[model samples]
Target: MTTETGFTNVDHEFFHRELDAFLPDRIYDAHAHMWKRDWASFTLGADIQNVGIAEYDRAIAEIHGDRPTETLFLSFATPDHLDLIDEANAWTADQIKGRPACRGHFFITPQQDPEWVRDEVKRLGLHGLKCYHTFADCSPTWEASIPDYLPEPFVAVANDEGWTITLHMVKSRAIADPDNLHWIQKYCRSYPDMQLILAHSARGFQPAHNLEGLGKLAGIDNLWFDTSANCEPIAHQAILRLIGPDRLMYGSDLPVSHARGRSLGASDSFIWLYEETPVWGEKHIRIEPVMVGLEHLRSVKWACWSERLTDQQVEDLFWNNAARLFRLDT
Candidate 1:
């Protein structure tokens, strides 16, 4: 099941067989990350350590083969390393400087100054801002009563610049949580000019959560959702049925999602290139390296195909939507 291309699972083959092709003309990856090796100690785990620009590009090429693809790079969310927000943002700026196909989103801590964020975005030519309220143990706890992570100043700056905000929601129930829903509604109404992208269908890992959340937010025109790290079929079905393809964008959530192989429809940890799964065959059967990021890419492709989307819809999800949102076409 392993190939020299760095994929472990047969899913990629399955995708090709099902779709009658293994590659698309182009892939506008809406979500991806890169980090400095020195920041390893600050990372949440060893699997994510040593992930930098080179590794990120390798993962993308390994997944899509020779097909052309573009990446929108977001800094790795480091809750414990909030002090490194400026440094992380700067690092991303440096990584994408000459890479025309790549765009970077700077990270903003809850305590960051709005003027500073606005200044930094202009200084680094950042296309957007990323807000992570709950990603790790050091991340802020999700509560209905908590204040907006992006304060008024940051919101104002985003609106003024027409920049997108990629939000990874906090809380167990995700977008279905009453408190989160309330906040999103308020934010969308208050800042209609700002383009809001809800990561992972608002993190709707379960069917019911997807239904309730996407259904509730269907009326918000400014709100968009990205297919990043979300592999649930039912949620994707709901996304198409509820919000339509125009607002649905593609994201691989690379590096973190690519550090190892994962069992489909399971919460298992990343299996390294050298690790073996007994279920596959003999004990310690060395498994071929599988690019988990490709798993995400293939999964989204399957989602679009499953929905019986038109060619235009597929193009919109994978390319046009993200391009328009990020102003990449220009």
Candidate 2:
């Protein structure tokens, strides 16, 4: 029952039954990616090679239907493609220009000069910064400290400009890790103007990390989170209950959204089950996995339901919160 677009009959049914009525009419995707295929050092499928505004619109429609969508488009570049960083960031700026509702973030590396980074962001008209752990000069970069990639200098510039930073932090224990907590606290406390968005529910693929650490992060006014590609109900539920819905935003994590799989919390960590994952089923029955986007929507619905959030609160997660943060016209 898989369609030409990669969604299946199961996906449609899940959407209509579990998500259609629950979703608001407007959406502001707070953490989607945009990149050129050729710029990638690794291989990209033809379907996602040219993921600019147009491709993003079509991809989001598959999940959001006819809802009008705005986005915070993150420029995509990996450590392998560091040489093309400027070109990739410029392309992001070009794609989002003239689209007032949308905004873009300049991809930055730790090695770049802080002054140059600030000027480049201003020149490109980008609203903020997007950084990843891969750029850290450490073996097994997953465990690298936050400062290794997103350095203090870059943060100072963001604070000066009142820019937002979408950070996908990595460590074995995620937000609960002592080093992660220290840097996050230092940055937000020292620079009140810079808004810090903890992407993927603070990388809470393991909900325990959120439950264990979120209590320590309370009362930070400039901190926020985006539910990007995370399918754990408790990870988001914890945020709603602890941080309030005003600080939580919905993110499709597109391209990954198009993939057929769901991320699951396993023991102290988490694992992703993809279409090719052999554990989809056993001898008793078979299962057809839906799109990750559908699974993510369902998770958000469950979190809202568990927290008994009002419709207005739900709207805030999907749209209003982002609008308020970006100062976009509603």
Candidate 3:
């Protein structure tokens, strides 16, 4: 093992019994989306899930080896589809009713008035709201603002309710300034009360993109970031360093990538991920020691893939903080 971070030959078997308990009693996958039967839910990548709610449950059981006591669902829609807010919100809320750990987020857009969303939010037991930052659409309420299309009313409701929101957070030609995340901040400065979750660890703490903004986020108290789709090293570390533990949450953009992705392939992916389960508590690394490392292991073959953190830190990122943040009853 190299001294740098303790080298290990990691493969997909990296996801076994060790991670089985990292979540303690349970957890909340802070950033996730469910595609309804009407339209296949899609993340930014080429990956698409023809499967709907059931698939998410299977992912919680097999991949996480634990069901999320709650999952904050993001609306995976482009600008054109933003008007269907109520339908999308209802679909996710129904899924939540079916699963204990499920909650919905409105990908609020200015394309329509925020009153529809405000009304919907009141009807649903929502945990957060999502804003599409790259939208090129006209607001029914106000002028276009950074972080894209959210109109004044949507932000107003979020600011009033003390609810959490995640900006689409993709660095874009339209959104050249990450500090527009500051837009949420700018408004919150006046409200001094609303909460917002910047997605993708604010594009992985890129200095030009968002680190400064993340650093500044601490001042807002209401602004926080989620590690959704951010399993890479620099992103995690930057967040751990800047935002600290309480604000972070576990989010695997699952089915977005093979629930198990190994350069090797499906079978190897599983074998490599769950390698520790087959043996007794003693092995090359010792089951107990590596078991401590399990959550880190399951967090994506970080050993060979990326060594930005230690096994214990991963355990914290993967489940502990999530449990705390969501106040998962489990």
C-alpha RMSD for every candidate: 4.7, 1.6, 10.3
lDDT of 3 by residue, 245-311 (tens): 5566666544443322211112111123333344445555654222212343344334212545555
lDDT by residue (1-330, candidate 1, tens digit) is 554334545545643554336345788888887776554343323344555566566656656666677888887656666666678788888888887767888888767778888888999988888876653224345642224565556767888888888888766667778878877788778888888888876676555677777788887878888887765666677888898889888887765464455323333111223125444454768444444555555667677778888888888887888787777767
Candidate 3 is scored at a TM of: 0.67
lDDT of 1 at 88: 79
Please list the C-alpha lDDT of all candidates, in the order they appear.
0.69, 0.90, 0.53
For residue 192, model 3's alpha carbon misses the true position, in angstroms, by: 3.1
Q: TM-scores across all candidates?
A: 0.82, 0.96, 0.67
Which residues of candidate 2, in runs, are more than 4 Å off?
A: 1-4, 41-48
Q: Output the worst ten-in-a-row residue range by lDDT, candidate 3.
A: 262-271
Clash totals, every prediction: 1, 0, 12
Runs of candidate 3 exceeding 4 Å displacement: 1-12, 17-25, 41-52, 66-69, 79-85, 98-101, 138-147, 172-178, 205-213, 257-330
Against the true structure, whose lDDT is highest? 2
Model 2, position 172, has a per-residue lDDT of 87
The residue pairs found clashing in candidate 1 are 8-290
Better of 1 and 2 by TM-score: 2
The reply for model 1, stretches above 4 Å from the true place, is: 1-23, 40-52, 135-148, 261-291
**What's the CA RMSD of model 2 in angstroms?**
1.6
